[model samples]
Target: MTGSVWLVGAGPGDPELLTLKARRLLDEADVVVHDRLGCASVVQELPPTTRLIDVGKSPHHHPVPQDEINQILVRGARAGHRVVRLKGGDPFVLGRGGEELRSCREAGVACEVVPGVSSAISAPASAGIPVTHRGLSTGFLVLSGHEEVDVDQLAATAFTIVILMGMYRLPTLAPALVAAGKDPLTPCAVIQEAWSDRQREVRAPLSQIAVESARAGLANPAVIVIGDVAEGV
Candidate 1:
């Protein structure tokens, strides 16, 4: 009797944000693999006999490699233990979930994906900022803050830009947007801990966003929005 793997999104930092399906899976999982970003509290809902594994990523902190996680999932499923592979935000959105799904497929393990609220949109909404408005913004562009991506293209092409894990790259962002022909005074805002009671919002323009973020001490699990869509709030 081979077991199955469930890739569950734990939602942006709030345990209460978990989907009903995710909650049901946690309650029944025989083995649970989770990341640091997702609320660990969800494990509390699991049966005491359930096995828990943490595979979190940090700037310099020690963390389990991805391949190891894949192996763990394969091993547990082969052992006939129902496995729940949990992650932060939506599993398909930059969560490296595709890799895990491929691993399960190759290893002959049945797997399913459960969607969760993404911080990309939730974080912005938490700050009372909308990514789109009737005429302010038609849509939004989502980007990774850690990659060495071309900020110019993002600034020029994206009406409302949402940057995940981008606080560290703020110093170079403004100049890049200016070079991309985006207004230096374009309204922007950064929201932290979306859907959580501790959430905070900082509003500024491209010209001063970096400076304001520094002053406000805004950090990770945060989202940055650029354009007039963020200003109407």
Candidate 2:
């Protein structure tokens, strides 16, 4: 008798941010597999009898590979245990929830998704900035600031650009944006460890973003926003 899997989003880093459905799933889950960002807080809500598996993936490090994670969910479900696959922020928002969902479907594991507030919007809000304002920003774009980022295609898009997991690629991005004819003085901001009390925000223009970020010593799990919307904060 195969059990089911719940693909739950733990929401940013706050346990209180979890949905009621997610909370219920956590309490009922016999086995929980979680990411590094929201795992610590989620575990605090679980009963001691529940089993916990740490599959946290941090920048420059992957504690558990994706294949292993897929297998864990399938194996646990096949063992007739209610499995919970937890993630930070929105599971589908760069969290690879899509991949996990594909694997589960292929293995015939029943699955469900519980949405959570993504750090993409919440992170900027923590700094008092709005991704979209009445007049400041008509819309915003979210992109990965990684080396593989398509600077040309991204620049062509008119929405305010937000980059995730791109701290290490800031140097390349800054220059690319400028070369694409974007205003060198366009307002930019980077928020580190967003949504946490220790969150740090650094604001600068496109030309100075890389330099400013380096000087501020911003690290991974940070979010970058490029547009006039930042000034509206």
lDDT of each: 0.84, 0.86
lDDT of 2 by residue, 69-182 (tens): 999999999999999998988889888899999899999999888888888888888888899988677888777655486677776766788888889888888899789888
Cand. 1 Cα-lDDT? 0.84
List model 1 lDDT by residue over 1-233, tens digit each: 89999999988877788899998998899999988775566676678898999888865564788899999999999999999999888898878899999999999999999998888877887777888888788888888887887766776775788888888887798778888888898998888767777777888888999899889888876888888877756
- After superposing candidate 1 on the true structure, give the runs of residues whose Cα lies further than 4 Å from its correct spot: 60-62
Model 1 worst lDDT window (10 residues): 37-46
TM-scores, each model vs. reference: 0.94, 0.94
Q: Model 2 segments beyond 4 Å from truth?
A: none
> How good is model 2 by TM-score?
0.94
